[model samples]
Target: MNREEINKLFGVTDEQLDHMAAEYESGKWEGGVGPIVPGRPRIYDEELETISFRLPKSRVNAIDARAKRNGETRSQFLRQAVDDALLANA
Candidate 1:
């Protein structure tokens, strides 16, 4: 979808967009699109969905240990595991 579509989806007004645009064009704006926030946000390349499943306690412990050791999050470790499994099967 386009900027207008996203704006409409988020209930952003045309005047608001113009104001933000003006701020950016005039070099007064720092960063971010619409609202002012605290720290840097988590940006992803694509949209993500969450799923839940129950695993053995031991298995979860193993995952957490490995993730910490590799300096990665649980989600990252699980995504890598899924990708590797898929590629191996293919």
Candidate 2:
């Protein structure tokens, strides 16, 4: 649907419709289009893969404490550590 159609349908001004259209085109519609509906597919990039590993309670606490000391989350600390290790090994 075009901007004019959207403005007419939603009883909004032409400028508002143009702004909405621009936002949609830029993929900034986080709450989804128009009214909420069930089974609407969410589109996002799949560039990063999620991995989970379990460590001992002590190790987990240590990691969390170290991360807090460095003013970073455990995940961020692990990511930085991995990047540093990889670069050092290379």
Candidate 3:
């Protein structure tokens, strides 16, 4: 998106977006190019799809504890679990 559109979507001012863009261009942020110009399709090597699943509260607590023990966030732990499962199944 253009600067105005990006700012609107992110709920930031144009100045904020510009600062973010500059930071990204300077490689201060980790990955990917920042906002694209309006009307340009975002290209991907392969598309990623998201899914949601339900687990018991206790199971979620266990996962959170395990993640913390491993010094990872819950999301990172879950992603690692998925990757491991895929590799094992393959």
TM-scores of all predicted structures = 0.51, 0.48, 0.48
Comparing 1 with 3 on lDDT, the higher-scoring candidate is: 1
lDDT of 3 by residue, 20-76 (tens): 778776767543755444454644467767789999999999999999999999987
Evaluated against the true structure, the overall lDDT of model 2 is 0.79
lDDT of 3 at 61: 100
lDDT of 2 by residue, 12-49 (tens): 99777678778766767554556433563443355567
Best first by lDDT, ranked: 1, 3, 2
lDDT of 1 by residue, 33-70 (tens): 56544565655667778899999999999999999999
Whole-model lDDT, candidate 1?
Answer: 0.86
List clashing residue pairs in candidate 1: none
Overall lDDT per candidate, in order of appearance = 0.86, 0.79, 0.80
Name model 2 segments beyond 4 Å from true.
1-46
Give residue 74's error in model 2 in angstroms: 0.9
Q: What is the lDDT of residue 29 in candidate 3?
A: 57
Q: Stretches of candidate 3 above 4 Å error? A: 1-46
